[model samples]
Target: MAPKVTYSDLVIIGAGPAGLMAAAWASRLGLNARILDDKVDRVQTGRADGLHVRTLEILDSFGLANAINEKAYQLREICSWVRAARLPLRAGYADCDKNPDPEDDSKIKRTERVRAKEEEHGRFCQLGIHQGFIEQNFIDFLRREGRLNVERNTATKSLQLDEALMSDHAAYPICLRIGRSTVTMNGDTADQGWRSPQEEIIKARYLVGADGGHSWTRDQVGIRLEGGKTKVHFGVVDIVPITDFPDIRISCSIHSTKTGSTMTFPREDRLVRFYVQLAETGSEGDDFDTSKVTPEMITEKASKILSPYKLSYKHCNWWSVYTVGQQCAPSFSKDGRVFLVGDAVHTHSPTMGAGMNVSMQDSYNLVWKLGQVIKGIAKPDILDTYNAERQSVAQTLIEMDREMCDFYEKGAGSDAHNYDEFYERFRTFLSGVGVEYGPNALVVPAREDGSRDSRSCTDLDKSRQTRGFSRRSLASKIPIGQRLPSFLVLNHSEANIVHVHSVLPADGRWRLLVLAGDISKASQMARLRILCERMDAPSSFLRTYTPEGDKVDSVIEVVTIHAAPRHKVELFSLPELLRPFDPKLGYDYWKCFANNNAGEEGDFDDAYAKWGVDKDEGCLIVIRPDQHVSLVCGLQEVEEVEQFFNTILVPQQRRKATAAACE
Candidate 1:
C-alpha cells in the first residue's frame, strides 16, 4: 500500500529548549512547521537554568523578553572560594573532602563574586530562568505569533533524503517518518509500553535535530562526538534549604580543601541549587554506574561537603548526576537538507552554565537561514555557514570549559592560581556575546584603503578563535559581522527614545540602513535621491527580490537615519520608499530617523559622529536578520549596494497574477 503522506515546510525534532526556539523562529518567518518529541510533556524541573546576556538579547529580538523577565530569577554575582576549615562536616562526608586543615578557613576567606561580562544589546545582563518556563514561553509565542502547536509523543522513526527531489530547489528533499510512541485517548496516555510502525510520512524541505545530547537524530546522521570522558562527575540538586549557611541566598562556589568543589546557584521562589562534586564517579573508565546513583546520594554528599557550616534541606526539588565530558560533532549538517543543532553538536561540563545558553543560540543562528531558504528569498548555499560558524563556536566553548575545569581542580587563591585571568579572558563566552563569523558572502569588511569589499560568499571561518564579532573602523564606530550595537535614538515621527536595536527587531528581515548624511546639504540630498530611485526601480534588487505579493521592502527593509536635524526633514518631504505606505495602514513612520543634532534631548543627535559617519558624506550598511553587519558601501555607490544583496539573496521573479494587485 502507498504510505500515508503529509507535507510541511519544516520539521523539528525534540521539543526541548532548542527545538522550541527553532519552532518559534519558524513561526516568526511564517513557515508551516511542526515540533515533535517522544516525551509526552515538558520536563518538570532540574535542567538548564542559566540565561546569559546574549541569549536575553536574542529573546528581545523575538519580542518575548518582557514576558520571560517577569517570571525568572536574576543572578547578579557568582562568588567562588575554598573551604579548608577542618571543623568536621556532618555525617554526610564519609567519602568526600580527602583532607582538611584544622583551622585554615583562609581558603574560604578570600571570596570573589564573578560578574559575567556585559553587552550593550543584552539589557537583562544575566538571569537564572527555569528551562521549562523557557519552553512554555516559546510555545505561547508559537501559538500567538505563528498559530502553531507541538505534536507531542511523536517519535521520528526514520529520515532519509529524496535525491530525486533534491534537484528541485523548491521541493521537500528530506522525508521523515513519524508516529505516536504511546497511544493516548483524550490527551492521556493509555499504554505505558506500545509500538507502531510509521503511521505518516512527513515531506519536509528541511529537518532539524535539536533533539539533545544523546540525540537519536545525531546517531541517525552517523556524526561522531569527538572527546573522551574526563575524571569529573557531578551530582546536581535543586532545593529549598533550612540551614545555617550564610551564603545560601547568594550564588557561591565552595571549594573544599579535600571535599572537591560545590557550585551554588540562586534561583526563583527562594529555591537554591548546589552542584555537589561526586569523587566516586571520577572518569569514564572508572567502575561507576549512573543508574545506581540516587537523589539521596546527591543530597547526602552535598551535606558532607558543607562541613563546618551545617547544611541540610527540608525540600528537594530535583536531582541528577552526570559525568562531565567535552565533545563536538565533526559536522553539523549533511547535504544542506538535514541538520543537527544544540546538544546534538556539542556537550561539555556545566561548570560555567554554558549548556542551554549555547544550545538556544545554535537554534537562533539556524532557523532564520532555513526560513529564508524555504521562502526562496535566499540561496540554499547560505545553509553552508551554519556548521562552520557554529562548530567553531562549539570547539571554542569546549576548550574554555576544559580550562575552567583545570583551575577548579587546582584551587583558587593568590598562591594557587590566577582563576580571574582565565575567567576574564572568556568573559564574553559566558555572556553569550562571544560569537563572531568572519568575512564571507554575508559579512563584508572595510577595505584597507578605505574601500568596500564586494567579494561573493566564501566559507571562511574568520571567527574560529571564539572571539566576538568583527567591527568595521567606520567613523560611525559600527562593527561589521556583529549585532548592530545599541545607541539611543528617537523615532523621527513618534519622538520616542529607545535603543537603536529596539527599532530593528529580529523578525527575519534584512535591514538596509540608509545613513543619509546631513540631508540639508545639496550633495547629500542628491546622493539620497539617487539611491532612493535605484531602490524604487522595477529591476532593482530590493524591488525584484522580494517574495511574491510582498512589498518591495518586505524582505530588505530600508530605514533612514540622516544627520540633518529632525525638525528640518518632515515626513512628507521624503519619498514613499523611505517611509512606505500601506493603503490600509497609511504611512510607515518607523523607518526614518535623524542624528538628533538639535540636542533637544541631550547627545541623542550625535549618531553621525557616534556612528563614525561624516556629516558631509554618509554610507550604506546592510544587516542580517540576526543583526550582524553584512556590508558597508559608499553613500552614492548604488551599484555596489545592489551587488551586496545579489551576492546572497535569490531575487524572486514577479509572476503575472490572475488579477492586477495595486501597489
Candidate 2:
C-alpha cells in the first residue's frame, strides 16, 4: 500500500500560468497553497507569448503586470492585410486617441459603444510578453507577498480521493496523494544528501490539476478529456534576428506558397518567435520524429515564406516542435474537490493567441469564488458557475482557433476562395467589438434585452446623457468587467500624481463612494450617514462646497462648487471634490488621493460640468471592487441598496428538497 500522508489546504500540479495564478490568488485570499511542477526552471521559450487586455488588468490587481510590462514588447500598433511576400499591406500600431466617432448615430448596442470607448482609452491595449515572463512575474508576486512555496522538479505520480479522510459530513474529500521527489544537485552529495530518492506522499484538502495537456492528476481522477487531436504539426523557434522588416509586428501572420505559413511575434532579448506551419500531409503513425525539424529547416521555411523580403537570423535562442490539437475536459471539477485549469481543462490551437489569456482569466474567475467559499462569504454552490461560465468560452475559443487556422494556414486556393469574408469576420472579432459574456457571469450584470450576460462592460450607461458637460463625460468610467484604466491622480499631499490602483485595497471587496457636497445638511447628511452604516461598506466622502463656516478637514477633501440652478440642486449635487478631477487619471482618483497629499493644484471646474451633478446637492455612487456599478440610487432608502446587493450577490432561495441536499 502507498504510504499515508498529511494534508495541505491546497496543492496545485503544474507551475504554468494557470497553476501559478491559482496559487497566487489563493494566497491573496489567505489560503496556504503549494504548487508542484516537473520542470526545474521556467520554460525559456516555445509556449504562448501574447496577453489579452483583460489578462493584463487581472495581473494589475496583483501588482505583477508592471514587472512583466517592463520586459514586454508593448504592441501599441498592428498592421494587417494580405501581402504577396509577407510584405506589409498596411502597417501601423493602434494609437491611444483613435476613438470612434461619438456623434455617428448608429443603432449599435450600448455595450458595443462602451467597448469602443475602452479601446479608445488605450490603457487596455494588448501586451506582448512570453508565457515564461508572465510566470516569472507571478512567482515574483508570490515571493513578495510571502505566500507561494513552489516545488520545482517535483511531480505527482498518483492521486486518489478518499472518503474517510474527508470532514465527516463533507461531500468533497480531504484526501489527495502527491508523489514527490528531489533532483540531484551534484555527484558528490549522492544517496542521502542531495540526490536522494526520498518520496513524499502529500494529502491535500483541495487538488488542482494544472499539470497541463497530458495531466496525470486528471487521469487519476478519471476525468475524461473529450476532444479530438490535430493532424498537423507546428514547429516553434525563437531566434534573435537582424532584419529590416519595418512593419514586422507581434501579431503578424505570414503566408507563402514556397514553404507553407509562418507567424512571428516580438520578445525580449531582441528575440523573435516563429510559429511555422509544417507540411505534415500524411503521417499515419505517431512515430514521426519532430526533432528532425531543426533551426536550419525553420530558417529555410522562413526564407520561403518571406520570399521577396530578405529575412535572416544569426543567433538561435530556443526551438521546439509539437503537434497542435484542441481538447477539453468534460468538467473543471471532480467530486467537488479535485479541479482542473488551463491546459488541463482545455487546450486549443495557438493561432488566436488566447490560451494564456483564457487560462489567466480562468484563475481570476475561480479565485474570487473560491475565496468567497473559503471565507464563508458565499456558498460552495457558487463554484458550479465556474464550469457554467468558462466552458462556453473555451469552446468558443476552439472554434475561433479552427477558423484562424483555416484562414491563415490553408493553401492559396483555399485562401483565394474563402479569404475576404473570413478575414473581415476575424478582424472584427480581434477588435474586441463582438465578444459577449453569459448573464450568470460574476463580472457583468444581466442585460435589459434578455441577452446573455457578457464580461465586457463598456457603454453600460449609454442611457446617461450629458448635454453640456464635455470636460467630465460619463465616458471616463472604465467599462464594467473590463480592466480598470490607469490615470494620474493629483495627490495634493505628495504634490505628485500617483497611479489609481496603488491606494485601493488589494483584498477583493465592494466599495461605496459618496460624493457629498454638504455633509452637515442635517436631514440629507443623516440619511447618507445612515445609509453608509447600513451597507457595511467602506466609503470615501468628498464635499463639493464647504458651508461658509464649516471646517474642510473633517471631510475627505474639499473643492470649489460649480454654478447650477436651484431645481438642478434639488435633482443632484455634483461633488466639488471631484471638480478638479484629472482626465489623465481616468477613474483612479481614489488611489491618487489616498497615496498623495491633500493640497494639489489644477481646478477641474470644466471637468465637473458634464456629470450633471449640481454643485448644491450631494450624490452617492457605489462601485464594485472590479470597478463596475452595483447601484447608483440615492442614499434615501437603505432597503434599496440592501435589496440590490442581495439580488445581485446573495444566492436565491430554493425548494425544501434542493436546500436540504445542499445543506
Candidate 3:
C-alpha cells in the first residue's frame, strides 16, 4: 500500500530541547505541529546539564521553572582555584601557604568566589539538572496540552520543497518522506522483525532542523557551517564524586601547574560533572583520536589538575570526549520555508554550559514568529527577523565559547590574571540575560533614519531629539529589543502582589503596556483617555488587526500600569480600552496594575522608578510575545505605535479573506 500522507503547519526534525521548544510554541499558539527523532528514546544519561539564569526565566514564563527548581541543584557560587604563587591574591582568595606542600608550585589554592547568578537578574539562580529532565518538562507540557507526541524511532528518508508553492501564503510547501526504524544514538538498530518499518509522507508549511551539530536537514537545505575546530580536546564525565576537595560542593575552575584545567559542576543527586582537558592534539591531528579517550583518562587528568586534594569517583554515570570548535551556518533559514535552529546552525565548545540554553532560546525566538505567520495574525516579513536576530546571538556565543575554551586551556600561564576579569566582563552574556535582538520587523528601529545601532536605551536619546523627547529618560532602565526585567507590582483590582512577568505569559499577543503615570492627576488622565478613545475607534490598529469575531484584545492587548495608590483609584474609573469587557466574560480586571511604591522597601520595589518612567508623565511600550520590548514611545504617540504594528501585523479583514480564498 502507498504510504499514508499528512499535513502539519510545522515539521520539526529533532526531539531535543530545541525541537521540543518549537513544538511547545506551536501547541501554545494552536498550530498543527509534528516533531520527530531517530533516537529510540529520550536522553537517559548525561548531556548539557547547566541552566543559566535567563533560561530559568524562560522556563518560568512557561510555568516549568518551579518544577525544575524542586528537582535540580541550585549552583550559587563558582570558585576559581589556581596555584597560589602564580597570581596576585585578592580579598576573596584563600591562601593555602600553611599546607605541608605549600612550597610546591603545583599545589593549587582557591582564588575567588563569584556568584553564579546575579541577584538583579531574577529570583532564579543557575541550576544543574540533566538535559533529559528539561526535555521531559517540554514533553509533559505537550502531553498535558494534548497537542503533540514525539515520533521516535523515526528517520527522514528524503525532503523536498515546492518552491512554486512558496508564493502562496497558505501552502504547505515543504515535503518529507519519513520511516520508522529502531535506531539508537550509536547508529545501532534492533532486530528487523521486532517492528516492521512503515513510511509516510508529510507536508508542512514550515520545516525546522534541530537535529544537532551533524544536522541532516541543514545539509539537505544546502547550508554550510563556516568555521574551524581548535586544537584543544576535553573529556566530560558525570560521576558521584568521592573527594576531600574543600570546594567539592561548589562549581569551580582548577588549572594545574603542569597538567591542564578542570571545571567542576556540582549536579543534583550528589553527582558532579567534570570537564577535563586531556590533550592539545598538536601536529598529530589525524593520529590523535578523541574517540579513543576513555573515562579513566578523564578521571586521571581531573585528579592531576585537582592535585594534593583527593579526587576519585565510585560510579561513573556518563562520559564523552569532545574537541573545541566554533562554527555557525551563514543563515538560519532557506527561501523562508525551511529553517535551522539550535546546534543545527551553530556549534561550539560546551564548556560554558550554553549549548542547551542557547539552543532552546533559538527555538523560543523563532517559533513565535512562525506561529504568528502561520495563524495569519502577522505578515510573512516577520519571519525573516528570526534569522537576523538569532544568527548574531549564535555568532556572539561562538566567539565567547572560543575565548572561554582558550582560557581553560592556556590561562594557567600568562593569561591567568586575565581569566577572572574576562569572566566578570562577559558573565551576563554567559547567563543569557544580555541577548538582544537587533532592529527587525519585530523590533522597531531606534533612529528616524531606520537604523538600530545599540540595544541600549541611551542610543534612543540621540535618535529622538527631533521629537523633543528623551527616549533614554522615558524608559532609561528598560532597553528596547531586549527582555523586560521583572519587578513587583500589585493587581489594581485585587491589591495582591505579583511579578510583572507573572502577568505577561508567553501567549502570542503584542502587549501594549500603557505606563500611564499617576492617573489620578489631570494631565495623565486626559492623555490616557485620549489614547483609549483612539483605540476604541474602528480605525484603530487594535481593531483593524484583530479578526472581526475575536475579542478586542485578542491580537494586541492593552495592559495599563498606573502610578497611583491602589485604594485611591478604582478599576472601573479607568477607560474601557485598558480593560476590555467580553460579552460572555465580564470586565478584564487582570489587565490593570497599580505601581506599588511603598517607601518602606517591602516586597514591591518602585516599579516606575526601576523602569525609569516618570510617575506623572509616562510612556507607551510594545512587548512582543517573547516578552522583548519592541517599541517605546510617548503615551499620545498612538500613530507611531500603529505604524510600528502596520509593518508587521496583517489587517483582520485581509487575513480572513485570504483564509477563505485558501479554503
Candidate 4:
C-alpha cells in the first residue's frame, strides 16, 4: 500500500549520464519529470573520465559545453610504445627501412620495440573530465533551465505498469512504489540523514532505467544482459602519480616485457589515471573479489607493469578493480513503457572511454524523439525506433570493445605493434564522431537504382502518399542517417560567418535545410517561391506540427543556404515566406546564408562545393533535431518531402481526434 500517489510525465530511475541527459531533454521540452537516485550524493571520483568530441559538440548544442571545457583536462595526443624486441630490422618496417612488413616481416624477425611515437590524429582535443562535475552540470541545468528537481536518496522498491490506454491522452500508465530514505551524512559536515523511510506511489507515463551496469531496474523489468566476462582482470587508479616516466602526462599505453600492459590517462587538476593489466598467476579460474584488490595491490601492479620507469603516488582521488566483460540487453525498453539506457542496456570495457559517451548519446537520440511524442507532435509509434537505433549501436560498441581488450590484456606483448592498425581503423569510433546508425523507419535506406512515381503535382490524387527515393548520385557527400557535416556559411543579411549547425539547437525541431539554387535566375526564383508558399501554407508540416497558439518555427524551422554571390542578393528581396519574421524582433538575418565569401576575409567555406549541391540547382534536405540527415530530394519533389515529414511529425490538429479514436 502507498501513502501518497503523484503523477509525473517522466520518471528517470538513475542519475548517471543517461538519466541526467534524459531528464535534461525532457525538461527542455517542458515535461513534468521526477529523477531519482539511490545514492546520497553525485559521483565523487574515478568513474568515467573521458568525453569524446561528438559528445562535447552535443553539449555545445545545449549551451552547456563550457562547463566541461572549463573543468576537464583537454587531451590532444595519444603516445604509443612497445617493449624492447629486436631480432633485426631488414623486412619492410619503413621506419626500420629496416622493416615494416606488418604481417610478413613479423613472421621472420622480432623488430626493435623502441620508444613511443605520438599520434597527432587526436584532433578536436577531447576532455578527460570527471563524472562528478559532469553530473552536477546536468543537475544545474535541470534545476535552473529545466526547472525540475532531482530527488536524492530515493529508490523504487516495486514497479507496476498498467497497460497504457491507447486513446487516453493524459494517462499515467506506469506505477512505481518507491521508498525514500536519508543517506547518512559524513561527520565532517554533519547535517541531514536521520529521516525515516517513507513509501509512495509514483504514476508515470514513461519509466527510464539508467541505473548502471548492475541495474536493479533492468532486473525488475526482466531484461537480460546477454554476454560473457573476460577471464583477465584490470585495475584503474585515479591519482596524482609521482612518476619518472617521460610521457606520463600524455595518454599512453606501455606494453612492458615482464610486468604486462599499463595505460596512462591524464585527468584534470594534475591528477593522472592508470589502468594496469593484472597477471593471472596463481589466481587462475578463481572468482576474485574486486573489493579485496586494495590500493596497495593496484599500485604494485602498476609499478611492475611500468617497471624500469619508476611509478608511485601519494595523493589519490579514487580507485577501482574489475574484470572486463561485454553484454547488451536484448531490448532497451519493456513494452515501450519501461525503458533501459546506458549501462542498464549495454555494458562494455572502458578502455576507449566509450561507455559514458555512448550512454549519453543514447539519451540524446532518444529523449528528442520521446519529447516529440509527449508534446503531441509525433506518434507513439516513433518510440519503437529508440530500441532499433540504440541497440544496433550498442552491438557495434560491444564488438569493438572486445577487440581492444583482447589486444591490450590478452595480446601477450608481441602484438603491441598491432596498435597502429587498431588506431587507424577505429579512430573515428573512439572519438565518437564516426558512429553511423543503420536504416529504419526514422532512418531511410539508401535508394537502389529505381524510379519514383512519375506523376507531376498538378490536379493530383492526394491519396498518393507513398514516398520514393531520390537519385543517390546527387547526395554523394551528404551522408544519410548520420549527423550533418559542419561548414561555415555567411549570413545573407548580417554577413557574419556561422557554423551551419550552430544555428540549429537540439530543441526537438526538425530543420529543413533548403539549399536553394542560383536564386538570381528567374526559373530558379519561381521554384523557390513555390517551395516557400508551400511551406508557409496553413496545412504545411511547418504550420500543422506547431500547436495552434505556438509559432510555426516551433516544430519545423526553415533555413535556406544559397550558392549565389553575396553581392548579388539583397536581404529584403527574398520572399517573406523564406525569411519569416516576428512582429517584435524583425527579420531573422541568421536564417538565410550564402555559400560564397562575405568579403576579403578569404574564409570562404564553399559549402555548396563540399556538400555536392550544384552551383546552378541545389537539393532540399531535412535534418532531424538530433542532427541526423533524414531526407534528400530535389526542390520539385514536394510530395516526397511531405510524405517524409508525415511519417514522423504528427500534426497538432490530429492529436485529440486521433486520441479519441484510439480510445
lDDT on C-alpha atoms for all candidate structures: 0.75, 0.54, 0.81, 0.74
Spell out the clash pairs found in candidate 3: none
Name the best candidate (by lDDT): 3
Question: Where does model 1 exceed 4 Å of error?
Answer: 1-3, 84-103, 114-121, 183-198, 280-284, 414-419, 448-471, 520-522, 596-598, 602-612, 654-663
Which of 1 and 3 is ahead in lDDT?
3
TM-score of each: 0.88, 0.70, 0.93, 0.89
Per-residue error at 77 for model 1, in Å? 2.2
What digit string (tens of lDDT, one per residue) describes model 2 on residues 425-540?
55433433233333332333323322444443332333222111111112233233333334444443333444444434345555444434344355554554455444333221
Give the best candidate by TM-score.
Answer: 3
lDDT of 4 by residue, 1-663 (tens): 326888888889888888999988888888887888877778878799988877887887887888789888877656555443432233334442233243432121222322222122212457898898899898888878846877876877788767645345457878898776655644211123433337788988888889899888899878899987767778889989888877778787666544677777899998998888874534434566776788778888887766556778888899888777789988888877778899998887788788999999999988887778777788777777788778878888999887788777643244343545566676677666676553545655447522332212121222223656644455567767677777778888877888787887878888888888788777887888888888777877777778778877788888899877778878788878667788999877778988865453657677888778886778888888888877788876677678877876777787757778989
Count of clashes, each model: 13, 23, 0, 5
The TM-score of candidate 3 is 0.93
TM-score of model number 1: 0.88
- Model 4: lDDT of residue 299: 81
Residue range 1-663, candidate 1, lDDT tens digits: 455898998889988888988988888888888888877777678798888877888888888887878777776655555675533322332433333354565444324545645543356667776788888888888878855788887877788887888766678888887777665543433224445444688998888999888888888878888887787778888888777776777677667666677778888887888887786444454654679778778877776667666677778888888877899998998778888999998999888788898898899889999999887778777888887678888889999888877667656644454444556777777777667664665665555512443332346423323212222444446666666666777778987766777877878999988888888777778788888887788888887778677877789999888888778777787878998889999998988876766656754636677678777878888888987777777776667667666667776773223123533
Candidate 3: where are CA atoms >4 Å away?
91-103, 182-197, 284-287, 412-414, 417-419, 448-470, 599-601, 658-663
**Model 2: residue 186 alpha-carbon error in angstroms:** 11
Q: Using lDDT as the measure, what is the rank order of every candidate, best first? A: 3, 1, 4, 2
Question: Candidate 4 — which residues are off by over 4 angstroms?
Answer: 86-123, 164-170, 187-197, 281-286, 410-417, 449-465, 596-602, 656-663
Of models 2 and 3, which has the larger TM-score? 3
Residue pairs of candidate 4 with colliding backbone atoms: 92-99, 92-100, 93-99, 93-100, 167-663
Q: How good is model 2 by TM-score? A: 0.70
